[model samples]
Target: LRRQDLKAARESIQAVLKVAPDFGYAQQLAGAIEYEAGALAQAVTHLTRAQQLMPESLAARQLLAQALLRAGDPAKALATLQPVLDGKAVTPALLNLAAQAWQQQGELAKAEALFKRAAALDPADSRTRVALALNQIARGDASALESLQATAADDKGTVADLALVNERMRRREFDAALQAIAALEKKTPGQALAPLLRARVQMALKQPDKARQSLEQAAQAEPANLQAATALAEFDVRDKQFDAARKRFDALLKADPKNVGALLAVARVRQAAGAPAAEVRTLLEEALRANPTEPRPRLALVEHHLAQKDTPAALTAAQEAVAAIPDNPTLLAELARVQAVAGDFNQSISSLGQVAAQRPDSVQAQLMLAEVQMAAKNFDAAVTALQRARALAPRDFTVAQRLAAAQVAAGRPEQALATARALQKEKETAVPGLVLEGDVEAAQRRGREALAAYRAALAKVPASTAVAVKVHGALLAQEPAAAPAFATKWMSEHPQDAGFLFHLSEVAGARGDHAQAEARLQEALKLRPDDPVMLNNLAYMQVLLKRPGAVATAEKANQLRPQHPYFMDTLAVALGAEKQFDRAIELQKKVVALDPKNPLWKLTLARLYLDAGQRAQARTELSALAALG
Candidate 1:
């Protein structure tokens, strides 16, 4: 041994092999130690001995593979990981290693797919997701979200782990979750997730001291577990013991100098203390070099880019991450949202659909998919998604809201009201539902009953936005001036909130006070520049007034976000006014792309094509439209 540490190293590694005979790292290190001591034949003997003890050992196989590779046998190296890959319950980590080997073997597509499969197998595996997303982008799938969401949703194991953890935390069942985690600890004794998860559960259950104690133990067990160590450090930081946290990380780095989690966490702590972006980026780069598949540092980079309005750069980062981790639902879903905002509905829908398919129980994905469908006028699909969401979470208010809208659009407003009423009855103990009952009454034209319902709601519930909005909107028909004054008084008492402002704007708009309406709209736009309905209304008003640049503004609104189908009809008008007949037809194509079930956009496109002298294309489009209808 050049370092003359052979006896000590042999003893340490021998002890590991005794318990974990097939341990790849140990056998590979032992073989390498022998090789470095000018003992190639001896190295082969040690590796051969390891192969006998652990035929499934990647370390032994890898050492032999490399031994063969060095002796001009690349083919053998390529075949070395078969046993590991063929093992049951092949975790994403092992899959990642196998994929790297595949890449080395020049099987690009197989490599990419395996990376994606790995990502799908482990949704929380940030590294695998980033790698898959990056590879997907390389394949010219600029819509990286499509693959990312698909992978994330297609997990092979329990997909409800996060929700389970959250639910258990809510119930203060930290001990139960920890009991499950003990199995994880036994399998990966020094893995950071075991104790960090236990600590998080403890913290959520309001046992701060216990949480701190668990983190301390985790740090002791796994010095490279930055999650646990950093969490403890943050508490120390709050206690003005930043030096303690720093010293802990420093000592950890001495052991695992390339520990990405510790480096990234340490850099983040520095950044929060007003360190330079250059410093943060440097640390992020170092972490990424240590683990290229990780998405966390890249996500931080995306945030910084977004803050600077460098959307294209942010999109690029998202695209790279999605490529590497096709199964990462969050990255994929967010990428879809970014694309949607960038005027790519078809891409967005594809991504949203993938997310829904993979995670049928994801209320967020369901709601988002439904909303996207509503924009495209796929009312049936929207309703279907909302129904699924209702099934998953019967008590979620957001699901109720979407279901109500879908019902209205699907020519089932009566059913919508019924559904809302049923939900309301279930919540009669709460003031909000009683008030919502008033809305149902108003929808049925039972104004007097609606007023009674409102009063009932007010009796129990404090004066709030929902109540005021309902009260003013319902009361205005019978008592105009009095209603306006009351509405204004309530609005004055609660300024700067969007829901109230929307109501006040609607009131002004209904009164034919265009100036006042425009002013309110401007204020609302300041709060939400991307409000599609407001944008459409403002564009329509501008168009009617023959205002300059109305066409450009209308087009911008259409391109930027989902609008009511009414806006598409309005956009058709805007396009015709601007004499962009051909472009108008393509915009109509977009409408159809948003909702293939809707025939309106198809008819519009067919007519526009005929007017533009594309008779053959027009005929084909007309035939499709007829078939669609």
Candidate 2:
């Protein structure tokens, strides 16, 4: 069974059990076979019977405990191991099993102690050392690499070699990892482990084609290897073969019904394919039911709710996940993300602070805190957190970019410009730095310098739509008469870009050429027929032109994004244009309710009431807007 001949092993065990039904050893063997076959419940039944028949059999008890843990019942596993733990038998195997149970229960300190004890008792046990090394790695100890290297050198087996590959990857030593994986393949020819490790290393090196080929080879070499199959399914997802990924995950689930990875993978694929929300929800809920203690499905549920824009539901799911794994920094970080998205910025900051406090050296945690602070417009706090992150990851470009942006937001444009220029000098491609320079110069009203910066960026990356938009906007702001000719030339070059057409419409509007504005918006609409923003803009232009069907076009935009305040405001304007005064007033009221602090919604509401011939309501709304001022 350990050699993967499960059918033959099961048949032999069954034959022995049939001849001697009460034989404890045969029953234990049968139970082990079932466990290896992924029938956890049946394994538990047989193991329990074997324990009852031979109450003093330590091996039977150990197997039962392992089966319980695999069944996602850590509490039951601890209970099954109680006798061995209390009797002080002190076997390295028993300590290792107990350590796993404690780890599953989130008792990391106890687990670490037990793992150390086991490693001390069996000094040459590679598996025990590997487990201890993993714990150390989780705590950010670089010495874990030494332990992992020692284990790999001693064992030359799958677990230790995989650990070495992962450690190398974590350290960003992709070339070294690849070399190690190649040697592993030579040592274990035709084995799936080496190919899978090679695929991961190739992925880290950004060699997608090589990674895909290695994944396929691994899957072919071991048809029953779930890790290989999962990797292939994930690769299919990346390739946009959603149906193929779903099929693979479905097969995995059918073979092992309680496979959490398969469940999550299928849900992810469905979500990516834009499957119905209810269908994705059902899949995630089923996974939660199957493995209630697993944090992955719960976190997925939180993300799903957030994507659907159900903030309260997302918060509730995040809370549940945090409750399940209270000490996990990753889960706590996820809770912070949900809180931030739900507009609970203070609470989000508090949660993130906890994670940073727990893992002071974690760059990811510090970066997350900085991001939330920036979103909250607490620029000074963001700067402080980002400086910490920059100290930790000095060469990380993203950290540098965000720090520069935060410095600009904090009213230190000179410092931001210096940082951006330094980044431009450091990198071979300096388009992003040039863009940042343009943004800073534009903020400082240095129009000519900003234009020069933008042009430089466009020269480097001519096809960059964002750079084109920035250049066009800067030209229009500085030299309005010259803007039209620049827009015309750019539009002629990028005729298929609806976004550029929209920018042209804005430029036309600023120049008070309503006809040209309407024409450009119409052209954009033709290219992006189903885009709600395009629909809203076209409808608004039609309303301004007093053209017919404006209401219908705005209604389509509203239907596409029912909760969007801007779309609703456009629909209200269209209603007023069509002389549906009462409907328009009601829609404005809803918009005001959505964003009460917006003086624009209040002013719009007042105008709608006056047009509806409701003097009292108009006076009240105008008074409110005046109070806001």
Candidate 3:
């Protein structure tokens, strides 16, 4: 075991355990072997047995606690260590482990106090000191910088130096971080971590060429490092080297064909490169086939179908996932979501109700139930569910916020305003509550009141792009003539804010100046290239101008955000302008289906059909449009 021959050690320990199954020492050795082998569950089982066999064995108990923590059962880990922790004589290691459990449980103050106690108990233990310093930094303590510096000075180790490097990077002291990373590299020759850190800092500094070189150095220093390779591939994607990124991910898949993560990564890269939807779906399906019970691939598949507006396909995928992972709450929740999207509200409600009944104390279960109930337009039911969740978690901001929204939707705006006022009493929730008040006012058609509330929200958070956008939208809805001036002033103050620029482009379009609108949207696109809404608008403007690239632009927008009725209509317009009548008609039909009540979409469908020379279909759509009018 000391030589790191964990495989041989595991074999030897298993053989001994076969003969002395009840021996505490053998069980303890087995647990150690399994832990060193990185088989955390097996290690926990063996260590638990060892503790049961030798109740007074401190080493056995400590090992069990360590195994439990590593297995991500931090509550059980704390319970396992409680006896030793309560004793008058507790080691620094035990205190550190308990502190980690508290940290994982989100009790930051308790974790900081435990870490301080551990550090005080053993001032010479550099590991505990480093942990304490890192915890202090995470908790945003003003003394963290001093603690980190002291730990780095006293420990003279790479771990503390690395923590200091991260803190420097967070402060945007890139040059200092690079120097520290270089010093660490000199101290530990042939280490991959220093180069990786250097590459990250270089990227943050916008030195892409230098970052690539550093990443290559990291990969060369550690040929087996999957993280370095993935990082390099992500950089290639950022640089628009799509083929290069695909090749790197393909190499990873070749090494481990059944790797679900690699498959998912490849699928994402393909999507970014505008690969065909079929190809992306196939990759996700392969990942699901590789790991039938893995939720990620299943969820991805469902989302993919949903993006295409293929609700039936999404429902099928969700059903298959639940079949594979029977009785799993997460998959069941996903199933209910797909059902709700497919308009099977009764089934969705029944499924979520079963889950909420089973996990009566789970706030998340109640929240999910509330979400589906809200989606189904059962606002009162949603309020009840959210109220139940609020009862379970009175301090939960999300639950309270959702409850207010549900109250407004249920026509109880007075109750919602009262709830919003209560939220405003809390400093952390003040801005959100103000926004909710604006939404409630807007829902009641009190446009002036809504604008006032939104302006108040923006006043409180002047730098918040989101609140600013809300204020701009409310201005356009309440007073259109004032929108352009407000947007112009906002752009002057925040030139790089893409959302405001997009809204400015909308105002220009509303004024019938398509050229100016297109130019503004193009500027916004430069800021956020993959913004589907901007792409759709630009494509529509291009179509109106009879531009040559509208078809490609519209297609790219559809690829980025598939299945939206409006985006689909824009693509159809662009396609018809380019004389791709067949595809245009096909897409327009789907758009009409999604928005059947919209006479404009029906008119567009009639035009596409006529363009495709399908006179019967055109007449049918025109008749439908006439009926709508």
lDDT of each: 0.63, 0.79, 0.79
For candidate 2, give the lDDT of residue 343.
86
Considering only N, C-alpha and C atoms within 3 Å, which residue pairs clash in candidate 2?
A: none
CA-only RMSD, every prediction:
19.2, 12.6, 7.5
Candidate 2 residue-wise lDDT, 364-395, digit = tens: 99889999999999999998998899889866
TM-score of 1: 0.43
Clashes of 1: 17
lDDT of 3 at 65: 81
Judge candidate 1 at residue 412 and give its lDDT: 77
> Which TM-score value belongs to model 3?
0.68
| lDDT comparing candidate 3 with the true structure | 0.79
Model 1 lDDT per residue over 489-575, tens place: 775776665667766777877877666666676677777787777777766666555555657666667655433355675686577
10 residues in a row with least lDDT, candidate 3: 221-230
Off by over 4 Å in 3: 4-143, 156-257, 266-286, 304-317, 354-364, 388-400, 479-485, 510-516, 522-536, 547-629
